[model samples]
Target: MQETGVKLSREIVTALVEDATAAPSMHNAQPWKFLFRPSDSVFQVYADLDRAMPHADPTTRALHLGCAAALFNLRVAAAHAGWEPVTRLLPDPADPRLLAEVALAGATAPENDLAPLYPAIHRRHTSRQPFTDEEIPRAVKDALSGAALIEGARLVFPDAWHVQTVLDLVGDAEGRDATEPAAAEELRNWTRVGAGAADAARDGVPDYAFGPRGRHGSAPVRDFAGQQSVPGRGTAVFEGTPQLAVLGTPGDRPKDWLRAGQAMERVLLQATLDGLATSLTSQALERPELRWTVRDPQSAMGFAQMVLRLGYGPSGPGTPRRPVDEVLDIE
Candidate 1:
C-alpha cells in the first residue's frame, strides 16, 4: 500500500467522530463505538452491545445498521477533510462486534464521491413531522436510487398497492406493541422525556423531536410518545399519500444489513442536498413476518432494511449525541 502520510490530527478525528455519532439509530440508541489507532492510521467501528436493545432488536440487525451509518458518515467526513478513507466491513470474523475499519490517507483529490455528502451529514435529520403532498422530482428520485446502487443496495419506491400494504403492516406492528407492553417499554426506556432531560442528556430521542400526534394520516411515523400524551403536543393531518422508499439488499445477513445502512445514509444525504426532508419507520420491518411482507414481490429488491418517508417538510430538530470522547478511544 502506498503510504499517503495523512496526519490524523486530534481535532480532525474529533470532527469526523462527531459527524459519525450524528447518525440516527433504532430509538436513538446510538449503539456504536470508535477506536482510532494512530500508529496504523485506522479507525475501527464496533457495536456497543451494552446499548443494544435485546427485546426490540433481538438479532442485533438494527445495531449493525446504526454502526454502518456512522461508518458512512466517517467516510464522508474524511473525504471532506481531504483524506481518502479505505473502508473494510467485517474485517475480522473472530471479532463479530467489530463492524468496520477505515484507513485515512492523504488525497490529492476528494475521496470517491463522499465529499459532496459532507454538508448533508450535518443537514440531514429524521423529520417525523408530516410532509406536504408535493411530489419529489423524478430526477431527485433517480439520484437517490443511484446513491443506493453505488453502495451495493437497492432502493425501491413501492407502487400504490405496495405502499398501502406497508402502511397496514406498520399499523399491525403498532397494534402488537399495544397488546405487548414489553415492546413499548423497551422503546420508552430509550426515550428522553421532560425539558431538562431533553436539554441535558446525550443519546436517545428527546421529547421535542417527537413530532405532533397523528390525528389523521396513514404515514408510518412511529408515535414515540405512545399512549403518554405530551402536555402541549398538538395534532396534525399528515399527507394521505406519503412518498415512501424501501431500502434493501440481496442478502439478509449481518454484513448485508450493514451495506443497506450505508446505502440508506448515502441516499439520505443525497436527498438532503437536494432539498428533501426524510424520516425512517422500521416498525413493520422490526418483526420478521412483517419484514418479509413489507417487501414487494414485484420488485427485484431482496430483503427490506428500512422504510423511508421523503418529502417537503420541516427538517427535524437535531437530537442529542454523546460527546466524541465518550464514544471514541485513541491509542
Candidate 2:
C-alpha cells in the first residue's frame, strides 16, 4: 500500500489543482504552474515567470502572493478529498522558481470545521461594486480577523480618521499612476475592455469583472471592462464609508507573502461565508510612498500585503480561469 494515504492517487492531484486554479490573481493571470510527482504523491507549484507582469510585479511579490493564495486553495481541496497536505514553502533555495511542494500524506478525514470553507471557495469573488452603507457587526469583524490570525498574519481595522487617511493615499497613488506613462501603460495592458482579441489574451483583467467607472471623488476600482470598453455596465454609487481592513505581517519576505496569501484567502472565504463582499485595492501599496501611509501608525506591522474593503452589495460575476490541464503537470 502507498505510504502517503489510504487512497493516494494522481486523480486526487487533478482535483486539487482544479480547485487551486479558482483562486484570485492580480488580473486573472493565473501566473502559476503545478507539477505532480506521483511517485511520492507530491505536488509542486511554480511561478510562471513568462506570465508575470513586469511593471506591476517586478519583484514577483504580488505573483508570489497570488500563487500562495492558490496554494491555500489546494490544501483546502485536498482536505476535502480526505487527505492531509504537508506543505513546504520555497523548499529549495537553489530552485528559486519552485514556490512550494505539497505532498499528500496521512490518512485523515477532512476536519468537520474545515468542510464549510470548501463550499465558500467556489462562492468567493472579488466584488468591486460599492458595498451597502450598513456597518459590519463587531462579531463578524472579529471572526474575519481571527481567520487572518490563524494563518500567521494580523488583521487591523482602522479608525475613521485612519480610514480617511488611507483613502487619501489611495487617491494619491491613482494620480501618480495617471501621470506615470509606464504605470498607466501597464494598467492598460492588463485591463480587459471587451471580448475581442485583446480580451482573449491570456493575462489581464477581464471585462465582466471590471467595476463601473467612477468620478474623481473616490479612487475608482480598476475598471477591467472599461479599461477596454466592454459594454453593458450599470452605474451605481459606491459605499460612502467602506469598512477598510489591512492584512499585515511583522516582516516582508517571500515566506511572509505565502503566509499572508493564505491568511488573505481564509479571510476572504470566511467573509463570503458570512455573506459579505470584498474588493481589494493594492494600488496604493503598488507605489512605495503611498503604500506606507495605508499602515496604521499605532501598529508595528511592517508592510501591508493588501487593502481590503468589505461590506454588502452585489456579488461579483465569476471570472474565467485557464483549464486545469494547462496548469497541472503530472509525472
TM-score winner: 1
1-331, model 2: which lDDT tens digit per residue? Answer: 1447444466766777889988888877888999987677888999988878777677788888889999999888877777777889999999988999988786545453454689988899988777777889999999999999888999999898988888888877777777777877777776666568444655566766777765433533765542345568777677677789999998889999989988998898899999999878787888766777788879877889998888888888787777788888887
Stretches of model 2 off by over 4 angstroms after superposition: 1-10, 109-113, 197-203, 215-220, 225-228
- Global Cα RMSD, each model: 1.2, 2.4
Residues 217-296 of candidate 1 have per-residue lDDT tens digits of 88889888987767678899999999899999999999998999999999999999999999998988889988999888
Worst 10-residue lDDT window, candidate 2: 219-228
The lowest-lDDT stretch of 10 consecutive residues in candidate 1 is 104-113
Candidate 1 to truth, TM:
0.97
Q: Following a full C-alpha superposition, what root-mean-square deviation does model 1 have from the true structure? A: 1.2
What value of lDDT does candidate 2 attain over all alpha carbons?
0.80
Q: Give the best candidate by lDDT.
A: 1
